[model samples]
Target: MARKKRPEGTRRPNGASSIYYSEKDGKWHGWVTVGVRDDGKPDRRHVKRKREAEVIDAVRGLEQQRDSGKVRKPGRAWTVEKWLRHWVENIAAPSVRETTMVGYRSSVYKHLIPGIGAHRLDKLQPEHLETLYARLQKPREQGGKALKAATVHLAHRTANVAFNEAVRRRRMVENPARVAKAPRVEQEDIIPFTREEARGLIDKAAEIRNGARYVVALSVGLRRGEALGLKWSDYAVKWRHGCPKGSTCRSRDASKCDLREGRGTLTIRRAIQQRTWQHGCDPDGSCGHRLGAYCPHRRDGGVVESEVKSRAGRRVIGLPHPVIESLETHRSHQEIDRERAANLWADEGWIFTNRLGRPVHPTEDHRAWKALLRLADVRDARLHDARHTAATFLLELKVPLPAVMELMGWSNAAIAKRYMHTNEEFVTAIAAEIGGHLWAEEDDTDDDDGPATVRLAI
Candidate 1:
């Protein structure tokens, strides 16, 4: 394609906004976009001034490189499989949970390596990604359908992470996945409940004896594992007791149960994971609720913790007064159940336990949630959206960002920002105050056109 040159003060069509100058006011320009419009397909465009080209021709040359797809430099030829193994081993394994490592390995090997393993690291481009992603979106005739948007987004992000590592290692110069146009996330109106709605939900939860899953999720915004993995010891009702329960319990206090003057905190330590066994069935497989005075399970006769669904799951969360009260009431009910069941009930020490005193699984929680939503006449929203609700509530309360970050255990402020949109009215008022003169009132003088001529900033 030939480069096109624009005159010094010419405006292009609205669609040509994608076609940017190689250098501002330069004689040549280049453009490359994804997706097809009636106007044009996504392709490179270069402008040249044959009538009066620049003497230096730097912009023209750069535009040529873009047109021919020759801007990126060549790098090592490692296969996706090789680099992915390195990514898991060197980068992701130590930092992330074992479960997360397993999932990442599975996705890379099963989906990515088999699909794009042979492509050279240097030759890969956004188009390659687009083609692979297109196939992933199609339904299979036999059974399985396309992946969900969230899953696809994860895969894309995983690819970007791997490529970023490659760049850092000098294995590749640029990340092909970084510039690729990912499938647009379908924006569903899955808003979190307002404060009143949340309050109503909490009240409803109080009626259900085994609904601490909802309570913890609402109060602390813990993930499912963090909530389910909780044990009786994690709770500190009457006295400073055992280690904080859940995946995120504080280890520092694990050795001793010290209660400070401030409101009590629930420590998240170990999570209950469902693991397959062979030799013999573990009596405490379910990691069920333990009465602090339970009999004949271990030498110490205390609550036990086991594996959780994933590693990112183990985390600690401190509860507020409402959560503590709800928990106390819930525990009282469970104690009654345990007294009736007696030895028949499992020796498990889960805080939020069933009639059998076993820890509740995620599936059970889902079913309960669905039923509760119907009962409460509330629309269905995912469990994670509850976290969004909590974040928004905190923002509205004028809580500092750092406090929110700490409460939510967010790695960065950027992600927290995404969960809550800024208050538009506040922003507008601030802007108006700063630039009041620009919008100052003046006498209206009608021009030939219908509206009066007003000073508008360029």
Candidate 2:
């Protein structure tokens, strides 16, 4: 067939838009001017379509995007990997907390990048994200490792946020990730120790060295990190018989005091965490030279203090009498250890520390907790469940919802309510309360006698 040609006097349309047949690949090519470069030259994007009609459609879409001021000028090529790294390092790291940044980096690098990082940032589609989520939900034996819905959700959030930034920077017309679907996370049932089980655990803990730690965890619902981060100064004791005249109340004499008749308060302000240091050591060898040293890294490898998990986590809890007594005994025992170590003792002031006077490792604490559970012959339960036990006990005692929320350091009542589980006994009691009046017998002898008389019709 003969190729159609334009007339010699005819002129091309103005405004930098064109569609022509590309003989090289037997395809039609479309180009549209998006903007000008620094050198004042036209910046154009070339899109190819197999058919001439398709090319026309592509050119029309490009024109619409450009006229609507949604078209972004093409710059350096950006892959999903590059954009994600840049976004996390430049945008997210500075704005979020270190712990949060750690999570973001893990989600971005480990999952997001490996799944779809090679794709062009501007060309990302909703189907790509959908496929990623579907694959993540499959089992490893099926050529896909199943991830928790929560983990997948985190990845979705990271990608969505990054793509949103791309849109804000005009790097792309829209964020495909915004339309992607993620699985919903279900709330896990709270498992707490029964009162008897809790007592057994406490008794077992008492036989151990750091037994007071468990007591505090159960009594006050302090997180493990918060309990480990506690200092002697955070404790305030009100003596039963008031301090004798002007006698200075020293922490060393805590065990000697009659704690059974005293009340105590613990102020939770911080938590202890073992975070990986990006910058390990300074040029000088001055790091970790002394106890409680201000080193970026630990000398003997110890934890560093960090802010509480949330604003609500910072709270003042009134300690139970048993817990107060346990703490007093613990302090006395700690003083004995210090005296034995003499000059070797490191006074880091952490309430729960190793013999070297450094904070206890969470793993070691876990081991001790497990041993205590075994010794007490109690059912297996996570250390965190102690907090749930405390909350459940408070709710069972008819403590007001708001009071329970404050005591548990929860920001909302809904969370506190989740910890309040109704067992069979409690359910039965509630049922009785609802139906008690309905089951009551009524007096009817006098009414029966009066009913024997007949009445005349009016």
Candidate 3:
């Protein structure tokens, strides 16, 4: 069948403007005026294809993008892999959280680099990116897995971010990813523990070592890393002396005989993360370990306390009376553990630790949480669900959304609405606030060594 002829032009002079059959290259061609040159002549982009229909479609697409402010001038060269690596290491790394960087690295190295790395950066187009997304959803036997749409969307986002940086750096003029379609991410429902289940977990936690950790998690919506990163220094105690008739009394009246009463405030400044260790020794040396962890001179990485990613992550939370008492008990046991380990203890000052006083590995922490669930006769749940459970309790308590946001350390309200995640979790940046008074101190503690318990100076 003879191909249909495209019209000579379909837009104003400044729009897509023109298209024609080209005898010189036996192809159809189009030109869109993109900008004015220094001398005032129109600076135009040339688009060409063998088929008239293809040129028309390309012209219209560019025209639409141009009008919408997402268009870019035809670009110039680097391999997609080379530029992505540079963007991840030099451009994007310093500004992102460690966990975020880890995700970017996974997407870049484990997928993008290998998939489209060989393609020229300037020549990469939306179709290429679209193909990569489709390929990513293929079965595992075909070099990809049946990944969740959200996982694929994350990869798409990584590409979008990387190319946006490329455009900013003037390394590329266009972001193909901006035009590509990523898989649709389906929102998953968050299954949080019910009030009874929370109580059951709490009852069982009492029988486990450092059970106060779970208490803090379920009571307040602290991210796993934030809870683990907590230190004795972060907790400040205030004297709340009250009556002897009740072992637990919240009454402010000081009329009755009493011992010292105290309330604890926990400040969140950093998070504990398991980082991949890097080799400190030369690769050519006698050490032959494939993984850096086995390298005797491994120097660059290990479990670390990283500052919380956002401002909301660094705030003070007022602990409940029960939680405060549980912590005191937990602290006393830690002291005993320290005495028993004597000289063998690492003394990192973590609020929760193993027998050697090292930070509890996240995996081990998950295992312990699972064991506690069995002891409590509760249904299965991820340790992170404890965060969701806390959000539920906060709502049930009728805490203000903003206060709950501050208490939970969520970055925004929309995240809080995700009910706190129809999958996991929410924050606010409350400034040094405590019961009607300024109640926090500037953080002067060293990131690695958390020591010296400062009194909660309320």
Q: Name the candidate that leads on TM-score.
A: 3
As for TM-score, the candidate ahead, 1 or 2, is 2
Give a tens-digit lDDT track for model 1, residues 1-458: 45467788887764342333345555444343322434565443333552333422544554445455444333236776788778877888777755566567666866677768788776678888777777787885689798776666767777888888787765665788989988778776556676666776777887776766687777677666667777778766433334446534444443234432225567666665432221222454233434313323333222234454334334455677667767767878898999999998987788877678887765677788877777667778787777777777677667898777767767677977667644444456557665764785554776565754445432
Error of 3 at 164 (Å): 2.2
What's the TM for model 3? Answer: 0.73
Candidate 1 TM-score, C-alpha based: 0.58
Model 3 RMSD in angstroms: 14.3
The TM-scores of all predictions, comma-separated, are: 0.58, 0.71, 0.73
Q: After best superposition, candidate 1 residue 174: deviation in angstroms?
A: 3.2
Ranking by TM-score: 3, 2, 1
Candidate 1 Cα outliers beyond 4 Å, as residue runs: 1-77, 85-94, 139-149, 237-262, 270-320, 344-348, 421-458
In model 3, residue pairs whose N, Cα or C atoms come closer than 3 Å (at least 3 residues apart or on different chains), thus clashing, are 189-422, 190-422, 240-261, 409-427, 410-426, 410-427, 418-421
What does candidate 2's lDDT look like per residue over 264-342, in tens digits? 8999988987664443456434564432235566343346788988888888889877888899889988998888888
- Flag clash pairs in model 2: none
Off by over 4 Å in 2: 1-77, 136-154, 164-175, 183-188, 242-260, 277-302, 412-414, 435-458
